[model samples]
Structures are given as C-alpha cells and as structure tokens.
Target: MTFVIDRYPCEESPRLGAMILLPTAESVPRARRWFRKFIAPYNPACSVGDCTLMISELVTNAILYGRADEGWCVRVEWFREGTSLRVDVHNPGFPANVRLRRPDADDAHGRGLLLVDAIAESWHSGPSAFGGTVVSFVVADAWPA
Candidate 1:
C-alpha cells in the first residue's frame, strides 16, 4: 500500500517555537494534537480549542482549493512573536487576489476567514516569495469574543 500522508512532530519543542513544512491530510489531527502538546508544556491551562478548528479549516482549504501535485505543500509555522501565539499556513498557489465575501444566510461555506478574523488576535496574508501564499495570524493567550 502506498501512503500519501505523513507528519513530523518535533520532539524538541519550546514554549515559543515554529514548525515550517507541509502536512498531509492525516497530519491534520497531529497538528491539533501538537497545538495542545506544545502549548500545554508551557501553559498548562491554555484554551486553544478554537485554534484547532482554525488550523483544520486553514490547512484543509490549502489542500482542497490549491492545485494538487507532487510539489504541493502546506507550510504550518507556529511561534510566539510577543504576548501572542502566531500560526502561519502557507500553500503553493499562484498568487491570486483573495476577495473576502460576506456569506448569505443560506451559504454553506466561505466563512473560514471571517471566523479567523473574529477569533484570532490578528491575521493577514501575503506571498512567501517561494510563490506560495502565507496567511499568518496571532492568537493571544486569550481571545475576546
């Protein structure tokens, strides 16, 4: 059997660390697991339940909306730039203007970034120069509703 999914969790983790690479579908869970693993080591009472959701939504979008090929990759980088936790999800997609649309009452999707905007402390997107889109955000120790 050929395996298409793989994950490489860092055993040498830090309170403020980073993960820079792509992840397969199976690694989504691992990504969330690491969220808790990495944060709990420093902040035992951390509340990142929503962070996991954002990660899944962002990562899944890259895998689904982006062109698939052997070169396809989703880079997940997490670190603390100050009093906030930052997560950057990068994908190999030709730079296209990303227009944010307000979803209709009956719309089923297109609200991921809206949710991200509401929950994350701050968020933004840009090109990584490697021809990939880098969407970054900061998650405060606690995000207000």
Candidate 2:
C-alpha cells in the first residue's frame, strides 16, 4: 500500500470542521464510524478511502503510544478546505519519534507513519495545544470539486 504524495499549495479554506474525543483504544472504531457518517454528505469528490485509512492509522498510533492509565484521550478532528481534508489526531503524550524504517518482512509492526507519509499530501507532528502531541495530515483529494 504505497503511493506518491502530491505537494501543492492550496487557497485559504474555511474553518468548517468537527472534533471527537475518544477516551480509550476501544473507541477508535467509533471515531471512524463517526467520520464515515460525517462525510456522507459530500459528493464522491472526497476520498473517503484515504481518509478512513489515515484516521485508523493515526488513532491507532495515538492509542498504542500513549499512557492509557493516565486517561489519555485521543482527540480526532477534521476540517474541509476547498477540495481538501485535514485530519488530526491529538494524544496526551509527546509525539512519537516518527521515521521511515525498512522493517523486515517478519516484523509485524512499525509501518504506520510510512503508510501515512506515502498517502497523505502533507503531514506533520508537534506539541499539542492541550499539552501533548498532535499529528496532522492533509488529503487534498478528499474534498468536493
């Protein structure tokens, strides 16, 4: 599952968006389900497939890398700008040291960010405004034409 990421500057987009807070790993699916419903109104121009895949990967990373015992909630957010979609996952922990790794075939993990970098038009991570980390990506094709 690899793809080339297109880099292009887009115009200023409206701030229209939504946010969801998932308090546990078990709630990741609920976030996806919510996103599905959230994007149903858009015409087929939006890339639902990419959005779903990225959402799962980002949320999974948040859950697996955060301190669950500390009530670390994963905050998922999305915004629509022109024909693009920005998805962000905020975790109550510092951002993971993300890097591309040539994992062995026998390795069962460590490819999440690789997949994200391959698919997302642009992505980055940094300190969250809420005192943790926020990983965000923009999918240019996931917006209405």
Candidate 3:
C-alpha cells in the first residue's frame, strides 16, 4: 500500500527525516539504528537512548498489529519542533486499538505503549489523514540550551 508522510505546517516544525520499513520482526532493531543515525548530529541535546527505545516499541507494534500481511509497510518520521522533537509511526491498523494496558507480571508482552507513556512528554494515537493509524510522541526540551 502507498502511504504518504504527513508534514506539519512550516510554522510548527521542519521534518528531520523519514524512513519506510518492512513490517517484520527485524524492523525493530533497524528502526533503532535508523533513529540513532538520524539524530546523531543533534546529540547531547536529543535523548537518543530514550528515543530509540520508544521507536523500537512503536515499530514493533506496527509490525505485529498494523500490517495485515507482508504487502503492507510501516513509515516512521521525525520532526524538530522548537525545543522538542516529535516522532510518528504510521501503519495500516485501527487507531482505536492502540492503547496502554496493564500487563501482568508473567506476561512477556504488552508493555510497549506503557514504556512510551512513562517516558514521552506527550503522546497520542489517531487516524491518519492519508489512511490508517498514526501514533505520535513528543520529547520536550529535546534541544537543551
């Protein structure tokens, strides 16, 4: 499926970078690497570790729940929003299905969104204008003084 990456108004923020990933288990690590490389120049100001972790979770969810088959793809985009950084993960999934759940101690899964909630300065999920769901999060003071 062809998906378009939505761009915020220029007054809001400029996009840093974007990448498309195949919906697969391997994409999780690939996303992390790509995120790190994409934000390398902004180091010290940007929380690379935290952002990488969050992106990993988001990408994993896109692979597991978003894609109906190998034919679909996941898109990740990042933007520099003033002193903060915003990242978005888009997939062909139901927007309403993205939520934080209280995972049981024994459960080996379902903690992805939980981690995102605890770390991100702000976050939300909704239907994308181009189609499908888009989960986005912002990290405040990303460009520290």
Q: Write the per-residue lDDT of candidate 1 for residues 63-110, one digit (tens) a residue.
A: 665554665666676665445677777777644644456999899988
Clashes of each: 0, 1, 0
The per-model lDDT (C-alpha) reads 0.64, 0.70, 0.83
Error of 3 at 50 (Å): 0.5
Name the candidate that leads on TM-score. Answer: 3
Question: Which is the leading candidate under lDDT?
Answer: 3
45-111 per-residue lDDT for model 3 (tens digits): 7578999999999999988888453377889999887788999999999999998899999999999
Candidate 2 per-residue lDDT, tens place, 1-145, comes to 1111222223353434454555556666766777777566544365677778888888888877765455456777667766787877888766665445777889999888878889889999988887678888988866546
TM-score of each: 0.73, 0.78, 0.87
When 1 and 2 are scored with TM-score, the better candidate is 2
- On the 0 to 100 scale, the lDDT of residue 16 in model 2 is 40
Ranking by lDDT: 3, 2, 1
Cand. 1 TM to true fold: 0.73
Runs in model 3 lying further than 4 Å from the true structure: 1-13, 68-70
Task: Please give the range of 10 consecutive residues that has the lowest summed lDDT in model 3.
Answer: 1-10
